[model samples]
Target: MALKQSFSQKMEQKLSPQQIQLMKLLQVPTMELDQRIKEELEVNPALEEGKEEEEDEFEQEEYEEEIGEDERDFDIDEYLTDDEPAYKTSVSNKSKDDEEKSMPLSSGKTFQELMLSQLNMQKLTEKEVLIATYLIGSLDDAGYLERDLESIVDDLAFSQNVMTTEDELEGVLHYVQELDPPGVGARDLQECLILQMERRQDGDITRYTALKILEDHFDEFVKKHYKKITAKMEISEEDLKDAVHEIIRLNPKPGGSLKSSSKSLQQVVPDFQIVDEDGKLVLSLNGRNAPELKVSQGYKKMLQNYSEGAKLQKKDKEALTFVKSKLDSAKWFIDAIQQRQNTLFSTMTAIMNYQKDYFLTGDDTELRPMILKDIAEIVDLDISTISRVANSKYVQTQYGTFSLKHFFSESLSTDSGEEVSTREVKQILLEAVEDEHKRKPLTDEKLASLLKEKGYNIARRTVAKYREQLNIPVARLRKEL
Candidate 1:
């Protein structure tokens, strides 16, 4: 066979660098936008946080001349088109004095820092401290030392050039496990609970029996096999219940308790706020989402000086090129941010209007059937773009703060020939399960019959699928004494 050349043509779509940047920027929530802007500011010295002044008029002219009509076409009017409102105000029902405010500062030491401080209090040799530090680093977010001792020994020997034995590591680990969090260095859930139990001041029989169960019958205990446990341990049902209650009281996640104190707790920042103003729904972008950004005037001035200079040396030309590149990047970033704001506002506005009934009534049952395609068509954007806008973004409504994706649900038809949101069906399903008898929970077949009685003609398998989506277990798993 011989190589041959053939002519073929196909239509293709390509995203420019600025378009790619805008897509990525659109996906980040309000809480993370500030950090992203700060990262860009650090990398591109030509970017800054302030209003663009008139002093950079000469530089702006030169920049426009350097870049052609394609760049010039990227104006604010292009993004803020006819579909956008002229003056979209944020309406609030509360008076100015009743507005909620957030604390500007938070102060606390991290979990690792607290652990290290405790480690410093111990009177250990240099080698032992090194081993302990390695083990501490190996602790996961849940405060469990997930790495095995053999693996940790290898890591220490190879990475830190510190040769150590598993026995020595275990010795250091025991001391680390005594840290303030009570079970910070446990190897597993059982060990974490046991460590916390060991710290109990009262050595009661319940605690003793709980410890014994964990020490031996942990598997049976986890499976909730109360009959087996009571038989093997030769205890009555009430005694087994008391012992199991003691075990339940122990902290399964020892490291999680330190999260708040260690400043690891993350607060959800909504991207949009929908206010109910005089019975009408008003949508507004979060203040953090539309931060004021502009190009640095100093960099603009420098670029102007270089361009206006009579004699251009080799070094001067290179410097001018660098400045121009930075200036272009800064401009692109600012434009991308503005485009992101426009896209978010437009997408959310469409969603709010589409789900206006649900917002007004504050009822999940009132939500209309919608999907990404519907919103994409309304906003004149691609489905993928709409998906990026919906993924991590949150909206604060009068009812509560919810993810943007919550409003977009698949449609289902009832016996009366009316399209309804699947969310409505899920809501009814959730209520039925909550009111169900624990001794005899509703099975998927029974759930389907209940839904049919309520005018929703869903199959048993469909009920099971929706149940799984709502994170509800089966009847057998949900059953209780």
Candidate 2:
């Protein structure tokens, strides 16, 4: 078949750079917005901190008009040469293997560093130290060393120029596991718990029994088959309960304890604050969300000087173009930030009004059925835009700080055929689970039946889903001696 010549025209809707910037800014929470602004100020010389000047608009228009009159060839896109493809210049020249990719490690003492510090404190030979270092570095964020001893042996030989056997590695690993946080060098969940219990045994029968249970019948313990464990271990119900208690007290994620020390404390700054001003709700965007940013007046003066010249030199045109680009960028960024604040406030205000009763009463049952589209329609924006506002952003209320996402829930019909928020149902489910007898915890079916008794008409699967979402385990797992 021969191809036919084709001449067709089509239009595509695309996000402009400014729009893209606004969308991204909309997702930035209050705490990080300051850092993001500082980064922008560093890159764009035309942007400056402090309140935007009142005369900035008039001066900017003057400079822009001057540039329009002269320097017709002064275009920012001119920097992109026709000889180089735009995408190619923006992309990496190195192959995937050649690229140096670094993991984003936490600040302060890392998990590896903590182990190494402990290693230094202990008396170990040079070879042992290197092997232990490798092992510590191999531990994942969860604190478990998931690699096999054989593979680690091979790795030490090939990468670290160290020779070792599985037996020697095990010896070093035993010492490593003895370090802080208790379970830093275990290979799996069972080993992690056993390592922790080993430190806490203290010759107590409960701890001893717990260690034995973990060492032998870990599967049975996990499955809640207490009868089988009591039969095999030949322990009484009270002894088994004490053993289980000891096991439960142990940290499942030993590395997680290290993470707090290795990372700085994160403070959540609400992006919006809603106040109950006598029966009326008043919404205000966080002051940080609306920073005073303006294009540098110095850059504007330079452009004005260039534009005033009678004749244009190539260098002059280039300098003018550069200043214009910076000024334009700074202006765009400032506008994008303002739009972000407006978008956030409007979206959150709509949500506050939509769930007015909930915000007023601090009761989950008062929240109305709402989704992204409901607020999107109210704000005359896209669902995705509303989602972005709801993503990392939080709002401060009379009750407490909550994510914007907390206010939005899918609707669930009640026995009265009235639509209610799934959040309300989850609240009821949570109360039921919390109040249920631990000796015989409520099942998903039982929970659903209870919700129906309270007028929430949801299915068993949904109840199970909600239970899991609440981080509640099954009834069997919830059972105790």
Would you give me the overall lDDT of model 1? 0.80
Q: Locate the minimum summed-lDDT window of 10 residues in model 2.
A: 83-92
Per-residue CA lDDT of model 1 for 95-201, tens digit only, reads 44423433344458776877888987888899988888878777887889988899988989999999989898889999899887887899898899889878873
Cand. 2 Cα-lDDT:
0.80
| lDDT (Cα, 0-100) at 232 in candidate 1 | 95
Instruction: Please give the TM-score that candidate 1 achieves against the real structure.
Output: 0.73
> What is the per-residue lDDT of model 2 for residues 1-481, given as tens digits with 9 covering 90 to 100?
9989989999999999999998888888877777898899999998887654444223222223334545475543322112112111111222344233223445787777777888877778899999988998898988988889999999999998899999999999888988998877889999999999998878788999999999999999998999999999998999999999999998889998776678866767677778998999988766633456766767766766665555666777778778878877977887777677668778888998898998889999899989898998999999999888899888888899998888878997888999988888998888888888988889999998998898887899999999889999999999887
lDDT of each: 0.80, 0.80
Distance (Å) between predicted and true CA of 462, model 1?
A: 4.1
